[model samples]
Target: MGAVSKEPTRFTVEANASGAARYALGDRADFADVERGLIARFDEIKNERGETVLDASTFSFIRQGEDAPAGVDASLWRQSQLVIQLGLYKVVDHLFQVRGNGANLTIVDAPEGLVVIDCMEGVEMAAQAMRLFREHVNDKPVVAVIYTHTHFDHYGGVKAVVDEADVESGEVALVGPGTVESFNKYALGENVIVGNAMSRRASYTFEALIPHGVSGAVTQGIGPGGGSHFTTTYIAPNDSITATGETRTFGGWEFEFLYAPDTEAPEEMHIWIPAINAVTCAENANHTMHNIQTLRGARTRDARNFARYLDETLVRWGDRVEVHFGPHTWPVWGNANVVAFLESQRDLYKYMHDQTLRLANQGYHPIEIAEMVQLPDAIGKKWFNRYYHGSLHHNVRAVFAKELGTWDGDPASIWPLPPAENARRYVSLLGRDAILAEGTRAISEGDYRWAVQILHHLVFADPADAQAKELQADAYEQLGYQQEAPQWRGIFLTAAQELREGAATEGGLNTASSETILAMPMDQLFDFAAIHVVGERAADVDLRIGIVVNDTDERWTAWVRDGVMNARPQESQNVQATITGPKQAVVAVLLDPSRAGDLVSSGVLTIDGDESVLASYGSVLEDFDPHFNLVTP
Candidate 1:
């Protein structure tokens, strides 16, 4: 999925923001040397494509205001200020980091060469970061690249940093944990549904849809928001770190891995460089409170596991660490400071996990628990511990929902009316005028939440209702202004913009790139095909087809029976005729209609199966609309 264009809108700062900004500025951000190192290390850095990656223009918003503007929280604005401080920074002797270049890329100087830890989201960005590292830090070549997790932000820009030819020639090693499996599952499996939804929601989370200005996109709280204008590609890992304490020496630099799976990411690991006395927390511990459940939907992250891993990291190496850093944001240094940082982060996730369950067992609904749960004064009061990315309220609800499914013991909610029907009934009963009056009162009383809640009925009841839409947009703007979390602010602001103007006109998702689709393992491709099969259309059809990948010497049989699609390795020859082709060609036939004629003409794909069966299979494949409306039904 990609970004949608939005016109910049102007908003005025509220009275409360003034005090909040003063308080935020006064907070002791004890990393003076780190801030100094983020000064302009280079004028500009570009990728092979001549794309500007690390430049001043993208983050020009840093100089836009001296204080928090309207429709933005002051604490968040303070975080944004730190977040936008981009440049190559030296943590210790030979340990350097490229921050604010998409995602932070760490450079470890090894005996033979530099070992890059976690490439960023795009080639352009990662390449530029490396360029800065080379010119200012070291000119040594990258002998190895370590991906801490499965997230694209951590590993997508491999080609920019190191030559694939080097990796192919066994000169440079590509290392990660659960790299291939996690990438295939998350990036390709039902991506048409999941990826599209994520892209849309992520636009809000990263604030990619909004322009950067006084009243527009500000900060992602982790780093500057980055969802647009980046080329993404995947590189498979040749070396896997299977277990915790797995020690590996890259170019004679010894490093130990902490196999921290299912913390912030599904497959994540932390690296300890005993030589430098620093631990790379990967995304497990970032500057801000990370999502137990990100706004962009996925399997809810394990809060308990997340907390325990941090605790374990401290127990294993807390005393030895002098500095700690991650894929995003600056590093925290000093043995005492680093330990405190780790402890605070550990308690942050654990507190939410423990307290959420405590509240849930007391017969409280998820929504009720969200409101009731609050971070302790120690954790909540700290500037670093504040919810800039992850909100305590939403995370508490996520914990409740994770344990108990969405079904509360209430029967009325089990079969609630769809939005439009429900809204019509609500408007009829409450009366449209009455609802509007109440919404207006709520707005007057500075209760933007109530105004948004009640006015939503009027707008949905009658989508063409101009007055309701206007009022709702106004309320959303106010709510957006009040929010401390960047995602909440961006989401509310985007909704307000959509209401005032209309949904974005541009941006489309390229769900499967040629490289990613072609590189996908045959089993994974078949598994993905099974997911995209339209069950309703295949309810009456019982069909089996064999896919023979000549290039990979693999054959898989897939059957759509009783409205379910099942696939497995071809065990016996007792099947319908086989469609033989190269792996990529067969995948293209299934997914990319644009490539059909080319593949057929080139004789890369040929089917011996009944032509009707192939046609039927094609007909049952579902194509999702990427630009589905989020604010509206």
Candidate 2:
């Protein structure tokens, strides 16, 4: 049977209305800045197959100059309107930005050539952005590309803006925060391990499958949506800015780099332009509160570092800089406005960090701290510091997790039963009908959070319980409707949708970029291989394998013993199997052992040992399921 959905509850409508009344919805400054210095709007962007990658017309449902609908938060609706104003805008002299294509591409018209900062999320969007720039602005060749951070959205479309041949020939320089190895470690390595799980979670956060309408995805907090369906490419940065205050001249423009490690990204930096009196904070300081820990999951960011970096930026150029822009959101023009913006952002993180730790020291649990702590009106009331992307609730929890860990000083919670087992126990104790009755009562009382919590056990206890799923989904929908943060809303709504329709069988965004995989170092590749070995399956197997990469002149000995796989540099004597090939061929075999014979027959790989050993090793390696159930057991 098909799932049934519910409309916004009366209580949810009243809550949203009350929340909307608190914000100055009539404010025009943000709107003015969003549409300021607009050159021309992009009509459409298409990939090679004539598929529309990005089209502003798709978001026509978001009617500008209108009040928030019943299904959306008022504040988030405002952000959605601003982000959906898709066009190439002039930020300041010699600076242009193409906004609303996943990430904004900042262009600098330099004396030598155009210097581009961040090239959207995919090649098609990047190409369209550059095309818009050329059509409305200038058409000078791109002499340099600056990657502000290690995020894929920041540098994925590198090939579209500049030629790899030019980069190789030194005609175009690729500048970034850290060395190529460091970039690969954070960008490629971090995601490749447990990538399927992260991608599954990210689908909810980004609302990848959600339709665009008042009842669906409005904005991706910082932008209209995630990257369009196009080729996501990456090119390692050739030039690394390793230190703070390090200066590099690109396209006749001098840029001072402030290496900000472990803030928004593990490898991230902010650029200071002396000539333009402008600074690009990368993803550090945006129009909204940034994530201390993203919902999609990664290493927890240092809130203290986030604050310190902003403070450093403010102290270093607060008075001098006339404008401040970022990869996401509109620019803050004028010295006073920029300074105020920096101070607010700096305080935003610092306050959250200090307060979260303060509560932690006082022995309050992370959840308790999140509920008790509230931002001062001076900081929270500001439009720039509003919870559009990151919320105080989650950031506070993230800060606590980073410092105090997830234990919360409770013995009972330390080694609790797993979710499904715990749910079954609860069902045995309370009975399913009683739990459902309580959940329905909570929903009727406008306690959606409590309703979802109680219904959670029922759903887990019996996945086929339609009443429990419906009640939980209804509660989730109401909660989603009231979230000011787009990500929070997306998570809740996506969960509700999945609970109603069952989890999607197809995978989310395919982040396994071939270029990124190829750029990965040997250690990372070995590490990835180790993760694929199923411990239980390998318990009885013991094997020694030698891998020799001809192109890189690298040798490694991989041994599987004691239900685990370990690899070290250099070969060991008397290996059971030895595989010699180029890095590409070796990588292909490692990723898909079934293709080993084909690669060997095609002369791409030479195996000089027991061939059956390869099969034994492959037998233990398990491929991760990309479409694993998230909202279900």
Candidate 3:
């Protein structure tokens, strides 16, 4: 493999006055000021199909795909401009949008040898960034990549960052949490049971298509508020470390890895650079409060664990840290400032966790606490006040799920009817007209919280109610404008825009890579299944089997224990089937469902037992829960 450290690619960084002004506020996104500005801006806008116009002057970027050139749509172009500029931090102008992880990018400063953290969604963007990073040394090379967590935004594209020959022949070092095999589950259940709504819901949540000002805009999107969509691949860690105080050096940089698994992600960790006084918390700590439950849905994150991870990070590196950069937003420089930022992040989750549990102890249901959850003046005043990923409403559900479980304590809610059935019954009890009238009144009175609840019933009761849809859209529109969290702002605004218009047909959404999948082991993949697979599907079939990969002499068993799918490595057993093939080959086919058939045809797949079971097994699993409401009563 030609994984040589080349002469560094040289590049320059210049200040973008517009980006400087907007992001310079650091994390203090003033909601009152933001809201008023947006309301006035909204009056001048139009919801044109897929485009939600941002600022015209700033909404332009280098077009790299089949989509229209930047600025064809003011919103998309400007957002792309913002996404590209803000995400890259203007660190590399030559290196533009890669695997679009919004602001997330993977740059290899050759002089530094290799320093990549989170490859956005596009390979080209990563490639561009690599070039920019290389420019510094003129001949240095990328030696290692650090995937902070298993989330797609964290690391999705590898081919663009490193050559394939280097990955296969062992030229680069891949680092992250969980076993190397845990990351693949991100793309596993794509076909047969597609979460088409995820990209839709993602667009709804990210508001990538919306205008940036008040009415149409909100905080940015989530993760890196990531952009681009590309196939992902990962190089297995040439070295592995999975605990606190784990330090290792690659190329010239020293990394101290802190395992933050089970907090933000099932398999996640943070890296600290003692030399630069920089700490990459990955997805653990971000500008705004992250989702306890994401829209491209998975199981709710543990609030206590989420806060605890931040606390641990501060304890370990609070003194040495000079700058605090994350998967998103501007970095906080100075020891005192960094401590303050991390403390706010920690307290935000801590308060949510402590307060929510306190409410739950008071016998409050998920809905009650979510509606009531608020921060004191200190915490609420921070720039991260916006609910981007982990909105206030849904995080309460996550809190309840943690303390009381998803059962909601009420027996009736335990075995709920189909939404349509409940909708019909509820509408029957209260005439549709009354609900609509009440919803309208709530909207006028600025009781948006009430309007959301009332209109929800109207839409569910009569999915065809135009007025209800319009008013709901209006309410969501207002909420979106008011939100300061990037993801929340994007989601609320996107939803409002959609209801007012129609479902925005997304441009092109990217997929992940096999390298990234191989980095994930079967066990982590199966765990991912537990999170993404819909409960309704699991309730039907009961399947237990073991898989033995002949190529590696590896045996894995998957069972329905306690109504949950569990899989782990074990001695080979004469159970269901022993599939034979290279793990990467099998993974490539498994990455996308519709592509599963390619395995059999390519002769890479060989099943011994019921061949039909593979189809059934795939069918039984569901895609990510995309339509979940981030802001609900």
* Candidate with maximal lDDT: 2
**Which residue pairs show collisions in model 1?**
none
- Residue-wise lDDT of candidate 3 within 467-574, one digit each (tens)? 887888777755543443456556666666556655544442333233443655666555545554446666666666566566677777765533467777885464
Measured by TM-score, the strongest candidate is 2
Expressed as tens digits, the lDDT of each residue in 141-224 for candidate 1 is 788999888777777678889888788787898888765666456544533336667777776666766666546667778877
Error of 1 at 365 (Å): 1.2
Model 1: lDDT to the true structure: 0.75
- Badly placed stretches (over 4 Å) of model 1 are 1-15, 18-24, 28-34, 38-55, 179-193, 508-514, 571-577, 593-595
Better of 1 and 3 by TM-score: 1
Q: Which of 1 and 2 is the better model by lDDT?
A: 2
lDDT of each: 0.75, 0.86, 0.57
Error of 1 at 157 (Å): 0.3
lDDT, candidate 3, equals 0.57
Candidate 2, poorest ten consecutive residues by summed lDDT: 1-10
TM-score of 1: 0.92
| 414 Cα displacement, candidate 3 (Å) | 3.1
